[model samples]
Target: MPSVTTPPADSLLQHRAFVAFWFARIASGFGFQMLSVAVGWQIYAVTGRAFDLGLIGLVQFVPSLLLALPAGHVADQFERRRIVLLGQVVEWIAIALLTGMSLAHGIHEVGILLLVCVIGIAKAFEFPALQSMLPALVPAAILPRAMAVSASAGQAAMIMGPALGGFLYVAGPGVVYSVCGALYLVSVALMGRLHYEQAPPKREPATLRTLFAGVHFIRARKDVLGVISLDLFAVLLGGATALLPIFARDILHTGPWGLGLLRAAPAVGALLMSVWLARHSLQQRVGTIMFAAVAGFGVATLVFAVSTTLWLSLAALFALGAFDMVSMVIRGALVQLETPDDMRGRVSAVNAIFINTSNQLGEFESGMLAAWVGAVSATVIGGIGTLAVVGLWMGMFPTLRQRQRLHVEAAAPADTR
Candidate 1:
């Protein structure tokens, strides 16, 4: 195996393409986070139903579930920057339409959901391309740190975006949508300026075999499969954030601003953790570290589920974000290191499927359960499920649990032996 390369003293921000990409992520992420807050609040406010909030997640998830494979194939066969640019352009248009509709006072629940679907379709393509582009933007040795630094940008957006959205929502949902459109516009322009050496396209026909290549690659790599599936199940059940608006409005007796704070709490913790990760990479027993982080996440979710006070809930959410970031960074770097460059788009697509399922679909599950039982009960169950998954996964993937390092010089699981 080749010796593990150390990152240089030069800052990751020194790379112009990465800087451009970083800014793009921040701008888009800010818009998306704010949009999410506004949408969740507006939908629940209009309908006075928790199930509608879940529907918001379900509508967005449908497009990704259907298009994920094709989207991955598209990313591998086209210019990544262009694909990302086009997707953002579509998202910007959808936001603009939402802005116009809200300004007209004609926004209906159905219309909002339909537009969210459009944005989801665009995101379905954007995610894989954007994810695959990162390793190409910096030296492979420093990609982990670059990822951490880039993630900090997203965390910062989430922290500010929700609060800002809640504040702007006081003016009107129209105001929030307009601001989201502007941010997306900025993101599109930055993506347009992003430049890197062109890697030749894979230029493969769109057969089922090509579309599912990422699936095949992951199945062949047990550690990679274990890491991703662990994240998937952990997050899928612990998606208690879907019930935040309910807690804020009904239980906590807070307004949109309170909901915004609730949303931003996690980001605050994530941002702090990302900064720490940027400075210090996990060097040994990384597998144990990842599992511990997930365990922490489960515990924090339980705390939030039971907490009645605002401050306690916020504290729990903060801890949840911090724990999740540790696991996320470890999982991201490990998967990227284990996959070949040519297969990254497909693998990332598969990874995105897991992420979207755990996020969007999880929101649906939370909403349904919350309606059937109660928000607190639903969240408590999710937290417990997450804890159960950890134990099951630890038993199922002994190699992952026992692994010592993040970097693997070879892609195959057998190579380490």
Candidate 2:
């Protein structure tokens, strides 16, 4: 992989491979979002149980925890392009199998669960390898901008995927799943065009010892640990996405479009923030900014809990997304800067697990709490819990408070001795 010391804004645009990768990712993300909504809708229509929905989240998350390190090991031992290509192949096969099952009209709940589980397995390997490949496409200096671009692309897909999925579900879930499978095939084709400088992995034995080394490396560094923990707790508590459909139906008293707006608000906010951040990176006080942003997210969540008006709720969710984007940018930059090249796969694997695991756990927590304490109370309590987590993390990691931008140069052995 080539590393650029200085990257101009035009660099990413100038590279045809990078452009191809970005567009393919955008299309693939859109397809996946559609698949999720279609699958969840079908499951709920069949089971009519909230916990069943929560289980969808759980199934997706379990693979990340179990396979993250192994996936990382494979990523480290192979060419990243091949790794990503393999993921695309797996995704398409999973979707094809799912579509076939759905069209057969004899598919049961267990069958749907199995397909969703397979999707999760594919994702477990896909995200970390894709993230680790970022530095190979763009220079170190423009990494933040590159990340912002990718984030914005995903946000754009969020805007289109769900609304379209909802409309297509009315037509037929099998149709939506088939379309999604086709998109995956297209993504595979697009990814095939990406060309990168490749090198062979070290011949040293790949073992659990190396996996533990990655965990040990992250745990030993206060800076790295602080960033990961901040994200883990903040997102775990502040994520209200799991409860949105309930709010849209009961609290806001709005129809599908309104629900779509509520769903899209955060992405809209994140997309705008991403565009702004691309123009000027957060190269100063990145850690403080992350904390402050999370605090704002908590505040926004609290506001949304109390709001009845659709527009007001939308505003709150938008604010939450803006804050979430800040945390995402800072934490991602910190990880990219602190982790070594050889360790990137394993470290990013751990990071992916924490991030996705929180999302699943958060969904379960939010769903269960909402069932127990009612929706409003559950959301409010979660918001408050997120604030508490931020406060506690700040007290424990004083280094984060005095931080600046990440130093993109390779870090020393992280003082693990």
Candidate 3:
């Protein structure tokens, strides 16, 4: 066998395949972020209903919940690049539909919600393929640095996409959707440049046993289950981003531009932290740091919930992102390093389910709660709930709490079983 040498951390950018994949992430991230801002603004502008805002999250959540297992199976069986390309094609078509609706001056709440569901279905299929592709692209020794770089690029796009969306929205929703569609096309071109040779998959007949493999894999590992579940419930309770439109219009007394700034603030903080982590790896006391960071995220949410001043609220959001970034990096590294290659697609699908539940379902939960109580009161209560979850998880998962490093010895296939 030919010898394999690990690439130096600083030299990750020199690899052409990784660089292509990175740009693809940048394009897709920016388009999706911009599309989100446009959809939220358009929906709220037309209906002026908080329930409809929550409905947007619900519509998107349905496809992911329904298709996650099947999608994971497909990723393992097929060429991942083709799966991603097909998803982009679906996304492009959805964007085209939105743009046409915008141009016709017939943008309806139901139409926007339906298109978002279509996009969500496409995302459900694409996520596992994209996530599992990373480990194959870079050597294990530099995986942490590569992940940090990818996240930073994503954060940078998040910061730019919303602000650009807001600026273009002044012209009309048509402009924003048009720009988003163009970006999706650019992403397709970038994705085509990637060259990944997938290993032959283990041959197994379709069965219930094979489908549930990812769940069983996660359940057997206490550390993976602890971190994944911790993030799931914590973010489910603490999510406040779903209410930004209300905050911007009613509480903060700001317009679309202000809403854009509010959305971008968290990414700004995350981007800065990602850059730092890329330079300095979190090699020690990772579990302890992750726990503390989550607790801090809860406190920051509380501060944001009660703040009356814009500057103070922005500061609170920045702090919230900074803390969340630390937890994200640690959890992400653990997920990538601990799973066996053959099971990566399935495992990543499980992770995606946890994340989507926290984000989209959490948005629905926030909206429903905000409608019951006032938005401010709902947020304050959710933050407290997050803190409560942290305390409970720490007590329950002592092994996870005691974990000292991000690195884990690769388990034998039989050991995973």
Candidate 4:
């Protein structure tokens, strides 16, 4: 295994393409966060139902599951920059429509739901394109650093976006959507500045056949499938994010600000950990670290479920988020290091589908369970399930645990390797 080295924080900043990509991601992520908060608050405020919030996740996940494969194929075949721009354009349009409805004071629950679906469709395309384009911007040696920096910026935006969205909605319901639209436009402009070395299209046909090839690639590699499956189940069972509003309103007895904090706490923790890991590279013990982190997440979630105080709840969420980031870093590094350069886009797309399904399914499960058994039980049960996932993955996929440092040197393109 080749030794992994930490790049200077300024490496990505020095590259124009990377800078542009990072800026665009930050802006878009911020806007998306704000939009999510607004939608949740609006829907709950109107319907007075926890299940309504779950539907939001369902809408987003459905499109991602349905379109992500084709989007990945397109990302592989088309110029990545162009695919990114087109997705951004669609996002901007969706936001614009939402803004117009808000300004007209004609915003209805149904209208907002439709808008949410439109945003979901945009995301279905945007995510794969963005992930695929990363390798084109930075050297293989510095990709981890770039990813860390990007994740930090996105998390920071998440911290501000929700709180700001809640406050702005109080001032005027239209503020959130308007800001979201403007951010989308800015993202489009930022993406315009990126450059890519164009590659000829793959000889493989763009159909279900090619899409399944990505699945085959994962199945063929034990290590890759192991990492992916671990995350899939862990996130599927452990994700209690969508039910935060109920905890905020009923259990914590805090309002929108508390809700925002609850949502942001995990990302804030993740951001801090990501920064530390990026600065001091975690080359060896990658698998062990990921397992420990996920287990930590389960423990944190368990504590949060039982906590009565807002501060305790916040702390638990923070811990969960931080550990979750560790898992994300390890799994992401695994994917980047293991995947062939030619199939990165499709493989990422397939991964996206699994992740999306798990996340949305988790939200649905939490909501239904909460409705059936009560909120506290729902969270506790989910946490227990997450712990079980961790144990099972560890026992089942020894390759992930047995494997040591990433073969970064071997991952390089032929001549470089």
Best by lDDT: 1
**For residues 289-387, what per-residue lDDT tens digits would candidate 1 score against the true structure?**
989999999999999999989999999999999999999998898888887777888899999889877886688799999999999999999999999
Model 1 CA lDDT for position 134: 90
Q: Candidate 2 on 1-417: residue-level lDDT in tens?
A: 234344555777887777888888888999999999998999998889888887887788788789999888777777777888898888888788878877887667788888789888888888778888776776566677778887888888888888788899887888999989888887888888887765566644677787666688889888889989888988788778789999999998988778878888999999999887776766678778888999999999999999999989999999999888878877786787777666778889989878877887888889999999999999999899989998999899988876765653343334442
Worst 10 residues of 2 by lDDT: 408-417
Name the candidate, 1 or 3, with the larger lDDT value: 1
Tens digits of lDDT, candidate 3, 1-417: 111233455677777888888888888899898999899999999999989987887787888888888888888878888899999989999999999989999889989998999999999999998888988887665666678788998899888887788889999999999998998898899888788878987867657777789999999988899999999998999899889889989999999888877887888888988887777766678889889989999999999999888898899899888888888888877887788777878888989899987987688899999999989998998899999999999999888898876664442224432
TM-score of 1: 0.86
The alpha-carbon deviation from the true structure for residue 66 of candidate 4, after best TM-score superposition, in angstroms, is 1.1
Q: What is the model-wide C-alpha lDDT for candidate 4?
A: 0.81
lDDT of 1: 0.88
The CA lDDT of each predicted structure is: 0.88, 0.82, 0.85, 0.81
Model 1, C-alpha of 100: deviation from truth (Å) = 4.6
Error of 3 at 332 (Å): 1.5
Please provide TM-scores, in order, for all candidate models, with all chains considered together. Answer: 0.86, 0.89, 0.86, 0.87
**With candidate 3 superimposed using the best TM-score fit, by how many Å does residue 148's alpha carbon deviate from the native?**
2.3
Cα TM-score of candidate 4:
0.87
lDDT ranking from best candidate downward: 1, 3, 2, 4
Clashing pairs for predicted structure model 3, backbone only: none
